[model samples]
Target: MKNIYSLFGLLFISQLTFSQATLEGSIVDENNQSVLATVYLPQIEKGAVSDVNGKYLVTQIPNGNYTVIISALGYETLSFKLSFLKNETIAKHIVLKERAVEMEEVIISTPFHKLQSENVMKVERITTEQLTKNGAVNLSQGISNMAGVSTVSTGNGIGKPVIRGLSSNRVLTYTQGVRLENQQFGDEHGLGISGNGIESVEVIKGPASLLYGSDAIGGVLYLNPEGFATDNETEVDGTGSYFSNTKGFNSSIGAKTSGEKVKFLVRGSRASFSDYETGDEYRVTNTRYNEYDIKTGIRFQDKRLKSTLRYNYNRSNIGIPEEIGAQNTSKELLLPFQEIDNHILSLDNTLFLNNSSLDIKTGYLFNDRREFEESADEAALRLKLNTFTYDVKYNLPELGHFTTIVGVQGMLQDNKNFGEEILIPNAKKVDFGVFATTHLHLKDWDFQGGLRLDTRKIKTEDARNPQDEDFIPSIDKDYNSFNVALGAKYNFSETFTGRLNLASGFRAPNLAELTSNGVHEGTNRYEIGNPDLNNEQSFQTDLAFEYRSEHFEAFANGFYNTINNYIFISPTGDVIEDNRVFNYVQNGAKLFGGEIGFHLHPHPLDWLHWESSYETVIGELKEGGNLPLIPANTLNNTIRLELNDGGFLKSPYSFITLENIFAQNNASEFETTTKGYNLLSLGFGATVKWNKIEFNWGVNATNITNESFINHLSRLKADEILNPGRSINFNLGFTL
Candidate 1:
């Protein structure tokens, strides 16, 4: 402890005399009156708050071209770019316009960071605070509230994200600017991400291959990690939560500190849960799970170079819930469970040139997965995957109201099996892609377009000999494709906006689709692969409209997508070792969907808010058959009441919500129809100050009615299992 303090002391002393530039700015209302606001620089990870005089100052900033964002309550946000020189003190003033609600947030998933209202493509964002409100148990469930998004759930512990009728390898997930590559080809495999270190989630509902690469044929879910504190600031926070239904517990602690030229942060968290109960008061045995994770990062910046390094280690133990068993509530897992350990390391660097800048990112990932079933002495299956990836992007100098960016990305991966059963053969894969995009900003309209090309190669080792009963031959294949996207946003009127986008995406066949030849224990089926399968290509067109006013806000979004050579699994007439046999096949498919929502806050009672949203999707093959694992239509309604600051309560809020899911009678072969159900939920939250320290707390109750129902996407739906119900959750957090 003494040595640690000394090291910190030395680091703090080193930053006391740093040489850098400072940016100062003031904000004023339309009447030229002073307005207190927040001034933030995203790239520099520094910010300042304006005082009563409407003046804010951020010091120790590296010299470079930077975008500054100024935001205040009840006013429109302002964003602009300027250049700063070494040891220079620049001053600027900004005037704000009054708005009924807060301005839209800035989106970072795109090649060019811009406010959602200004971007040509529509993106959905959910913050950590919003996740907490939903009382979710995992990262996938945390995002299930968004429109056009759901989950293929096993129980309280396992869930895979489904976006616009797509799941598994079809959808892509990114964390800290690097693609997440776990063994996601299986139906029971969930996203191995902890919500503790994540600050927010951004979802692109349609194909984003022009920015991302192959596998993005469906969409992208981007997780933004928590950032460091501002300059010369230090903070520590602790949080705890409890759940009634599962007897679950979650705890975490984090600390961050930033100096003039150095910044660092660390966080540790743990969570555990027992078997979850159904609405009928019956427990789903062997559904228990536990997880532990640690994360740390450090960043340094000079006049022209900024660099950051981050690392995360995660370990999880999940039980495979099946038929009912004894009713005892034990957190320990029985046989037929999974153990996973994942490690991620990343480094990012940015160099500031005269006008244009270069950004470089590198990452390393290791995934160790083991499944134990029938006995506790040995693992039935074990797979180890290693991946190394890099990305480089160059931003050209702004010219004639246009911003351009060009980039290249690639990955190398190796997969090996060391267990009794091999679901997929040992393989080595390589991927490379290049893209260029440009954005044009006009007075009332914005236009953006991009093109990308990608190539992938796969080689598998021959694991079978002529003497073996089921010999699989060695395989080598190469896949390549080109994609493009074009989008436009127009301000139809002062209170209305419209956006249109057309995009194309492509996906190469995964290892499981090309090599699997045995039973998949997770899905309880024998699967066969096709070596001649072709790549899948998709084209989608999206249109959106938004209307905003002082009393109400409304939005409508629609999409139509078509895919060529869409791969799906069909049951074969033959049976293998008492298990049904399924083969991978391809066909043409189409999907259409739309979402509409409205928010109303009457003038006389602004504290009362009413919101309603509805989403639907239809997917079918060109040969006249329905697609499997399609989500049912859903509608959601919420009523909220907001309270002003009072004696000990600050910004107290309460809400009640109703969710209605429609029956899914349109099912594919080997699928059963699912009955719909309605759910009611309630929650409340408030912040209180004690001894000069503020504490935030909340309580949520889900499935208040205790109704039992099954979800169409539940893997256990075939077994007639019910979803979780009657869970009361409580959470508390405080800063030190």
Candidate 2:
């Protein structure tokens, strides 16, 4: 495309005739003024997410010297290392101080961290204050060791987060990067990802499709809330958790405060469990689980600007062990008057002047749901849904090193099933979109590109039967797609960096994949719908490499996929009396995958930590066939020993882990060949601060030596066993 506007018109005309040197900024919390949406630069290692008000703008070229890092989460991280002047653009604004429970160096000068490694991508982060234990469940058990990610369950109220071999909706969750569009259609919506109110969980593996959008094709997890905070200023703080693992027991609590301008937050948690045990005999009789949660939020900043507001409430009852009938039945998986409610509101702002800074954002979301199971005539159902969402964004500055991102998105819907007159007719649905992006800075090299446009509309309620009663014209449908992305990076020395990306993607056809007919029974199948369907194009590529130094680090990536239409679920009409009707098609597909990671700590001995990961995935069917549930070829590892940083032990630090997972046996196209297993896990932690009060205690061991495997996406089958058998998880908490 004019070579991406002639490489941003020659990197903004060589930053307007070489005179570069101006390091300015603004990222706030303690009443400084602006935090916009979110940001943290790290001398150009790249980090920006603020845009509801707290503004920013970074440029390039031999400007002498620099340092500026501002973080957000509960507030408390701002670095400064001044010196810049050459051809000019300098502005400054900073204020973030709320954490300090006794800094030991505060996790290394805080640049917003969670195990970093980038050149090709290796996010790996985990924070809920190190997983506020207390019966913690969901969000894949708080992303434990990361690396290629893994977590699958139909028990413990079900957990999902498998990457590499992919997971429903081709992975792509991001609660803070937006794009959780109910995960592109069912898997029981995986309990809507509720990790007892999360705060940190980023495992971005591969193909991020340019800042996330679409099904990510196969990567991007995000989910950041509560950035991170400790104490120092005017404040209130909290921590609570209690746990038991063998398949049960949990607790919850929360609180927060920071005043200079304004800041407040609250959290709540509750968990329950019963039924689980199976090493090949006895005790796998319909697992058990439960839940309850509530949350609140508020924020106001200074320096440039900042604002926030949040709310949440949840209720649960789970246990869906294959709805026994031949005599193994006793499940609920989600029922007790089954309920799930979500309401969200957001606003952000940031602006400076004299070089660049302007970012704003707004949001609103509401969802109401009630779900239960079994219906292929066995009868015993319940399904209801209502969703509404709106969003807006913009970022511009550094017209030279280029950083221009623009946005607009929307959604509206209403649904009902089993009410008879509402089976895929004018139930109402809408979607709209717009996008733009740019970012470049040369010398060592870095570049980016983007473009997007989307629109979709679906309705039903049969009026003339052009498929159903048209709330409009037999209820109509229309779709549009246009997307593009390009990337580059080069350094090759200093530690190594060389990456490349080429993308052209699009995904539109959600709303339950075009008018559903119900009887999903949560994967038991029988979900009929088509409505002509189309709009799923894709063409991706990636080749990467990264290497770092401190203790040790490494990353590698390789990918390729070519799809067109690619959406599946076919089998039209046959066996009406025995049961069979499936529909939801769009052929022409292909997929590929790759990933590898490693890290080794250098110091902290007697406080050891090491990590490992390996992954692979391959999907086909452009006439070759063999793509059903796909996910085989995986390996994960973790080893840690921290004993005591609370000195001599007793409460402050203690850790142990030896975990591994390998699942291979597809038997071709899922005729069931899952028989690969090895499991062992152990854990320990302690912390009980004095004066100001704080406490955290944890204990865990899942399948320690009780190995009874199966994970090709097990729904239920004990030909060799899978799930429920040998367990122990515990936690305790308090903070304020």
Candidate 3:
């Protein structure tokens, strides 16, 4: 009996061992000395940090294939594919190379998560930390720092992103892996998203319809959320910032904890700003704003599945400045202001199979927007929007050097009016898209291509009453389109690379474009929409070249885009109720632009860096005239110094930047020319450690010379309102 029991026990032990796998690795520098690093397998959401001896181990992994990423500070990140079998233990050794610049991270916006150097398409990425270091007061202002990206500003408190030369419904924004739908059709509407709890931002400068479908006809702005803490770790953090120009202050607190199988995190933030002062020391009345935001997330992971749920709530009270009148410093909103409340909830799940995986994501969003004009307690216009979206993708098993993914995405949306006035009729919208994409890799070449089909339907209810001046007839319409993208990346040498891509995109007419027959108070225009409107289709060609080495990096990117049936609203030489009349029309349009820049960190002076870049874009109708709201050319130069350590301060750094904006002479008929201007900025920061406590502090001054200027895309351009200037900003943060 004892011998039989022993045999059974041995069999059980063998089976248990065969069900799990182990991965072990050692990391070292070029000199073969131990170097601490992080080894992560994103697919399974598992990772480990190397010990002082440079040894790391991850166990209990199921049998499958994965891409492992190894990264460390001051070292070039490395990634490769690996396969593991049941009961198998894999041991690997890695040698990291020193780099003058920071290491590159995996790009999540792309279908295949790969390093920038390995992607077929060029994508611009900047971390929120970097944006903070640049002294950006808000997310919209921060993104404008990137090449080929600009913003249409109503004021410092409200701004919309304009990619290349397109805004409104053309550019798509995604947060937490889901589309952000907050009534984006209006020019005065802001992003409605807070900067708190966001990790990084990624921009795809050209059409990405093959991957993201409609609304991406112009480009995509992807916002990545902060990740949870490492396994069995808990952390708490707090941050506060102050801005002098607006007499503004913002503060946030967050906490995160992660165990072997579950993780949770939450963050709360608030901000208040008074009227902003211009370069002439004139306070712009009712430019003040206040915001409250909350973000939370939870995750569960096991051997075969990983799931995450996230939620975000935001409320904002933004004042509208018609002209400079009241100068008193007050954070409370005044008349002619907007109050917006937004809620977003999302769930993501991934199921890992033997050699493949499936990913599903779903999201729900609600937006309540109210405008107050006559009385503080009464809203002149109120609109409510609800949206539900879903996306499912299946990664097919890799075949040789080719990887493929097939996906389906769709959304259901409804809009309603709750106040006395209505900009758009009560409407319902449906969107569905199917796509397939694949990537082929070779020694020196990578080829990527995809095809997609999309369909959108819009239905509206009649809003024609005898007492109402604004009338809209009920209508139902369906729009369909097919798109494709093809791209190739070639390595010219170890340090040089080139890429070429051709893609097509399409966008269905929005509700405002098809049914509006009322006054748009925001633009002071009476608008008439066309019931018969065709979809806008675009084709673009992009070319880019990059060269990188230990001490220098340079890149040049150029693109040409042409659109058919492009929609635009133009003045009709008529007036109604003291407002100019405008009509929506379609025409062919073209835009061409490019960005070139370089970074130099000369040889032994690795801590000293010089960076310069220039960007320009030209837009015009195929027949005649220039397109509206095109940004002017810009040149940016920066000198930076990084120190290894300074007494009580660790990794102290400072930078000076000079930006020049060229005059916008190529303006539309109704647009006025904007004069060129220059701005100077300086910033410095350092980390301090005391006992077991560590904190970071920084100070930045923008428009140091107090230069007065107006951007071409500013709505206040016609009123000769200047942008804010000469602001000193201070920030402090710490982690526990």
Write down the lDDT of every candidate, Cα atoms only.
0.86, 0.55, 0.90
The digit string of per-residue lDDT tens for model 2 on 1-736 reads 2353354345334332234444456666666666553444432232345555666665442333333555664344455444455656777666765432111111211112211322223345666556544224455655634655665556556566766555666677756334554333555445354565576676665445445455665666777665323212333443433333334555556667655446777777776665565666455444565677776666665433445666656666555655432223233443322345555555544332233333344445454444444332222333355555544444444455455556555566665544333323436667666677675656677666777776767666643245542232334777777777777778778668877877776565665567666545535455666668887777778777877554566777777777788777776765343556677888877778777777675553424557676766677778666666555665666666545445433544444444455555543442466666766666677776666666556776656677666666555543334565556666666565
Model 2 vs. true fold: TM:
0.33
Sort all candidates by lDDT, best to worst: 3, 1, 2
Write down the TM-score of every candidate: 0.95, 0.33, 0.96
Give the poorly placed runs of model 1, Cα more than 4 Å off.
Answer: 1-21, 28-36, 60-65, 83-88, 98-103
> Model 1 clash pairs?
none
Counting clashing residue pairs in each candidate, in order, gives: 0, 61, 0
Q: Is candidate 1 or candidate 3 better by lDDT?
A: 3
Which candidate achieves the best lDDT against the true structure?
Answer: 3
Off by over 4 Å in 3: 1-20, 60-62, 466-469
Q: Whole-model lDDT, candidate 2?
A: 0.55
